[model samples]
Structures are given as structure tokens and as C-alpha cells.
Target: MASKANKELESWIKHLSGEDMPVFSGTVADVTESVNSEDSSASEVAQTILRDASLTSRLLKVANSFNYNPGGKKISTVSRAVMVLGFEQVGALTLTLALVDSLSEGVQRHKLTEEMAQSFHAAIQAQQLAKKMGCKSPEDIFVATLLSRLGNMAFWAFSGQKGTEVLNLIQSENLTEQEAELQVLGFRLRDLTVGLSKSWSLGELLDDFLSDHHGNDERHNIISIGQELAEAAKNGWDSEQVAIIFEQAAKKLGLSVDEVEELAHQNAKHAKEITRIYGVTDASKRIPQPNIDMGLIEEDVDEAKSDSTDEPRLTITEDTSTAVTSKYPEPDSNVQLTIMQEITSAIEEKPSINIILEMVLEGLHRGVGMDRALFAILSPDRRTLTCKYAIGEDNERLCKELRINLSNTNNIFHQVIDSKKAMHVPSDPKKLTGTLSRDTLTLLGPPAYLVMPVIVRSKVIGIFMADRNASGRDIEEKDFIAFQQFCQQANMGLTFLAM
Candidate 1:
């Protein structure tokens, strides 16, 4: 039996990682690796997300949603989203959105929808319970709970003959879910979830909860209650089973039974809206509506619509359909303006220099349509420059390779800093032959690029560099103007901090 189970698990894993959902598998792997690495910065994570324009837009929307951004602050860029929502929160949201995008369109979509709805419902329930218990990170609990049933969701999404057989066994024999999975697939779906969690490095909390479903830890107990409530609520919020789960949660959370009941009801409604925000509208519709007052639900819906309208919409010069299908990003004036405003707000609020740099880099990459953008800070000794934050293609490699020796006054980068002026390198290779060194050319490629000094209080503190090499597009006059403007904003922000 053990051998059979191992083989079955491996087979299912192979199937899921194969052609069925390659994009999702790749996303999970990329995001997990980036988020889990000790050296990974928020900029790195943002770059990972920004590679997919659709994912980027969806993540920003979720970050700006009421549940995530209660303060009503608009998140225009993925960099700001990472800063505002937190690194783990943004990573979790990316994984969630990727999962929905990958699995929402496959075969047995109805079953997938049920799994997605259940996960969302349980996630919200767990998050609410975590908040009530005063846990340090409710978002962690939410993500852990949502992905707890990964095997079940993935199975329904990509499984073929074996899946139908398992379903048939459950229906015909009246067996429980695990028994059906075990009889047909040689292992339980829960075991598969544990396997996938490990392989994907989803998180320690998820692995721990899957390993000990009935653990004594308070956080784990909350997760268990959340999943149970989601399952029981399928029968109805007022069902006896739900009542029992609520009673247990009330005791665990040190809350009255009435309070637990109310929280559960509110979370159910919240889960519905959150699922919709995630672009899984089908799953959102499948989520059971709590037996709450109709008037209150209507009021909530109206408020959500109003809040959405207030969000700054992206405005592209090209037609909407063409822009969506275009391979390269077009300059978005709306996003550029919004990010500029955010930078001003960050300066007023006394944010970290890293935050200011990140926003500027985002402005150059996404707003100004640069194929690659980076911020390189001068070493304290003032002898060398090193990349601190970067975005766009091959950013990780760019970060490591982007170094300039300040003593080389002949270099264009050094000249920019010395003069405290912005320079736009034309695409003509002849113009860069002497001024641009061979090492710089190898690192940045031979393309039109922009370099500007970030001056604070009349001192050149750093430099901003951007290029259109990835897209092989020539640096336009407007791009240079926008790049200079963003660098100026960064200088102003740093000056404010110095004050």
C-alpha cells in the first residue's frame, strides 16, 4: 500500500507539472523561490510579478481592494503594493491569482470552482479568526488555509480518468472523501497536499498544518475551525453542524457564541467579494451567501462599487484592445501621474530611502515604459556605484553586474554624476564607443539608455539608469523627459528626508 501510494503521488505530481498547467507550476516555482530567498528584495518580487502584465494588474487591484487597503490609499504600482501590503502578503496574493488564472479554465471547471470557493471561504474564515485572536499576521493564516487543500484543487483541475473514478466511489459507496481518494488513487488527497506543499515550498505553516490536522496549537486550531466551518456552512449557516463548529471556535477564541456566529456570517460574505476581486468570478458565485440581512449586503455591495470607481484607472495611448494584446508596454500617463503623487506622499510621510527608490524605479519601468530600470547608490567610500534596486528583464543579473568606478571620469555614468545632469545615450553605437566602456556595454547591452544623478541637498548621492534594450526600441524624447522627471522626484524625496 505504501509503495502504491508513493507511485500514485509521483504520478499525480508529474501530471500536474506537465503540460496541463505549466504556467501555474512555473509561477508557483518562481514566486516561491523569490519570496523564500533570504537575499530577495521587494523589488525582486515586484519584478517577478511585473513580468506578467495581467498578473500585475490583478495584484494591484487586490492590493487596492477594501479588504487589503482599508485606509483607502490607492496602490498604482506593484512596488507600492509590495510596500503597502507587505512582502509575504504580496507574494501570497501573487500565488493565489496565479492559481486562479491557471486552473479556472481547465476541464471539470465546476469541480474546480467548488474547490476554489471552499478555499477562499476557509481562508477568509481563518483570517477573521486570526484577527480576533490577535495573531501577528492574519494574512499568513489566510494563505495557509486557502492553500491547505491544494491537492484537491489541483486534482479536480487537471485529473482525468482517476478523478472520475474517485468521484464515482464516493457517490456509489457513500464513503467519505478520504476513503474514496484512498481506494481509487492509493492515497488520500490530504497526503498529496503535503507532498505538493513541500515540493513548492509553499510555507512551513502549511506543511505543519497538513502534517498534523488536529494539532493542539492555537493557530492550527483556528485553521481547523475555519475549514470545518466552511464545510459545515455548505449545509447552511444555521445548521447544527455549523453551530457545533461555531461553539468550538467561540471557546478557542475566547468569544461569545453570538460573536463567533456573527463573525462567521460576515466572513462568508467577505469571502464572496474577495473571490470576485481575485478574478475567479465563477468561484465567487459558487460561495454560499451567509444568511445575513439583505439590506446590509446591498449596502456593502454599493460601497464596494463606489470605492472601485475612485481607483485611478490606467490610461494608454493605444486602443484598449490593442494595448491588451501588444507585446510591449505602452506609456501609461495615469499610472505615471499616480506614482508621482505617491512619491510625494511618501516624502511627506518620511518613508525609507529604499521605499523612495523603489517607487522611482517603478515609475521608470512601468510608467515611463522602460524595458529595464535600476537605481545604483554610491558606496559610502564614494569610490564605486552599485545597483540597489532594479526592475524589468534580467533584473537580478543586472543588479549584480551593474557597477561603476567613479574614478573613470571618461565614463558616461561618472560624467552624469560629476555634472549632476541627466544624459540620454542615443542608440548609435559610434557615439558611445569611447565614453562607454566595454564592461558597461556588456552589462547594459548596446542600446539607447538614460542616466541621471540623484542629487540631495546639492550632493550627488546616487544615479538612475534605464534602457530600452529588452524591447530593442529607441529611447524617445518623451521617455528621456519622463525619466528625468522621476529622478528629480527622487532627489526631492531624499532632500525632504535629510531635512
Candidate 2:
């Protein structure tokens, strides 16, 4: 009964669905089911999310961000956030974060992070527009729009260069994204989303919203208009393209052209705040301001860069594991020095000792762009190097397996602790020595990795280990220097805690 395109899409869907798809939190699944049951409570949903410290921090950050707070009192606790934004909104946010966290691993994180920021921005804009149009429960609309974009996200994440070809074709030939996707990938991307939504048990509303039910379906038009404005603004706010998109959106939302343009500007500003909430700082910095000229936007971004710990280089994510290269020339020493200063300043805040270590791990994982990072503290008696914090896929497994026995004090980790030197071991047995436990080696997935000891008062207190793992980026000397410096700053924080 299916058309060739439909059949082909189903085949692709089957392939993707049958593959080990990323699972969101078990709590997300359970909480959603419990919400409809007889005995659901807001406290129950809040507790589930709080179980994961990272997710809890993320949710608190979003709840406290300017987008939601808007000069209101800051919401400090998860219970307060849950009370303010109803269970549905909190559940939706939890699902979104879980989805992002699950899918971001073992892929090009930088590229996924950009796409995720845009997707979140688009969903927010669409939801606001839908709410203005008298759609009840725009949160459902928000999650639906986001879920319907999974096919595009998956293509960009796992399809690699082939996906880029589809993207380039859309730009070069002026083809619709779906048209280019069909030509390049043998199926329309939306159809893949359709299949995935059904398979993933997302509500049928996603299908209806993504459909071509134009006249009676204001939701579809609102989402389309949001995407259009977002795409147009990416070109330049002052472009003729922006005027056209705004005109279309104005008609759909029953607003004047000026009103629609004002809405776009507001969304742009709010989107910037929301982007920061999710820790996508680079993407937040690059958000286009609808009223500002392109030149002024650059100046604003540069000014922001002055206050942050970033090196000003445009990064292009490629299919290759080592593909994220800066477009500009190599940065000078001042760049690293600036980031170290930022880290040191943050450490001076003297957050809880656990929070301090997590911040350092994030600095390595997100700032330094490592695929996997682990912070392993020495046991009280200094008998074992036990992974205490990890960021990446299979992190739980890594933590369990990366328990390095210090009984063999001649092992590589022990040697690094003794010498207080960082080591980057490339794919050489001579380089490996007794450094890697079999469990650690198995997790590394490649022949090489890097480890540096976290020393305090001239005594090794922990180990900082990171690698590209199956992503396959070879360790570079520059990256090692950055990691070593990160560990050094971490030591200062640890010492402060010790004192």
C-alpha cells in the first residue's frame, strides 16, 4: 500500500530504529507514564530528575536563566523550579535534556551542540507563536516540533559527509531541504521522522503537526514560519529574505509586519539566554540579533568573547574524528593563558568541593573538546585510582572499570603520579607500558590515550584521563598541554579544599 518513497523511508527507518538508539533516562519514561496514572505527584517527577546531578544542574540553570526568570526572583531549588513550571514543562525539559545528553555521545559533539541549540531555539519560538495563536498547552507543541526534527539531527550526526552533501545540495540548488534529502539519501527526511516518531512512541500529534494540512492546521504553519525566520536570520537580519519571512510569519500569527519583527527580536534575545542555560556557550555567542546590523552583531560577539574563556576561531565540524579544526591560524599562548585565568577565577568562588571537581571535568570535556574525560580520585589510603566523575558515553561502565590498582606502583598511572608529569601514549606498546589497566584499555578502544596526575602539595591526589576513544582523534601535543594545564588548575582547587 506504500509508495516507493514511503517504502524506502520505512527501510531506512527500520535500519535506524533497529540499531541501538540512544535511550533517554529511565526516569523520563517512568515519569511520563506515571503522570497519567492515578497517583502522580510533582515531587515524584522532581525527585527523578534530581537523581542525576548533571541533569539537575542543567534543569536549575534553565529555570534560573533570564529567558524564564525575566527579572524575577531566581529559582534555586529543583522543587521550586517544578512548582513554578508545571510538571508537564519540567517533564518536557527533562526529556529534552535526556535526549540531548543521550545523543551527544560518540559523535561530533560540537556539531551536535550547534544543531541542538538551533533546534531548541526553533522549538521555543514555535511554542511562543503557537501560544499566541491560542493553542492550548504549547509545551506539547514544543516537544512535538523537537521530536519531528530527529531525522534531520540523526542525518547530521551519523551520516557524516553524505549528510553534508545533502545539506550543500539544498543550499546550492535552492532545493527544499526535504527535496535535497530525498535526492541525496533516497528518502525524504520527514518520512523518516514519521516512522521514528511512531517507533519511539512519541504522540501522534507530532505526525499531524509535521503534515501538510495547511489551512486548518495553524500549528504546522506556525512551526514552518518559525523555521523560516530562523533560517533567514542566519543569512543576515537586514536581508530581503528576512523581510519576506517576517511577512509570512505575520500573516500566520495575525500580526502586523512590525509586530512579527519585534517578536523575532525578542525570541533572539531569549534564545541567547536559553542557549547559555544548556551550556552551549559558543552557539549562544553567535545568535543573530534581528535588529542589529551584521557588523554590530560581530562587535557584540567580540565584546562577549572578551569576557568569556574562548579563543576566537570559527570551528567547522567534519566527518572525520579529528575534523574540528579552526578556520583561523593557530592561536597564540595568550588564548590558553586567558582560559586558565577564567578557570582559576571560577575555582576561587569556592563552590562545594564536589561541584568544583565537576566544573574542572566540564572544562576539559566541553572547553577543551575531549570526547571522554574522567576524574579519578585516590582512595583514602591511596590504594587505588578510582574514577569519581566521568563525561561521555558508557560513563557508568568507565567508572566501574577504570579502578586502577596501585599495588603495582610501576604502572603508568603510578609513574605519572610519582613524576607529576603528563603523558600522551600513542599507539605503541613501548608507549603503553604498565600504564593502562586491561579494563581501561578496553574502554579506550584505541591504542593511545593521555593521563595526567592531579597533584596537591606535591602528592598525587587523583588522575585526570581523557581520550577520543572510538571517535579516533589522535592525541596532539597542544591538546596534551591544555589538559596538563587543566589538571594543574584542578590541583589548585583541590588544595583549597584540602586547606
C-alpha TM-score for every candidate: 0.89, 0.53
lDDT for model 1 comes to 0.80
333-358: candidate 2 lDDT, tens digit per residue = 44345445645655565655555555
Off by over 4 Å in 1: 21-41, 172-175, 213-215, 292-327
> Mind giving the per-residue lDDT tens digits that candidate 1 earns over 103-136?
7544555566678889999999999889888998
Against the true structure, whose TM-score is highest?
A: 1
- lDDT (Cα, 0-100) at 465 in candidate 2: 86
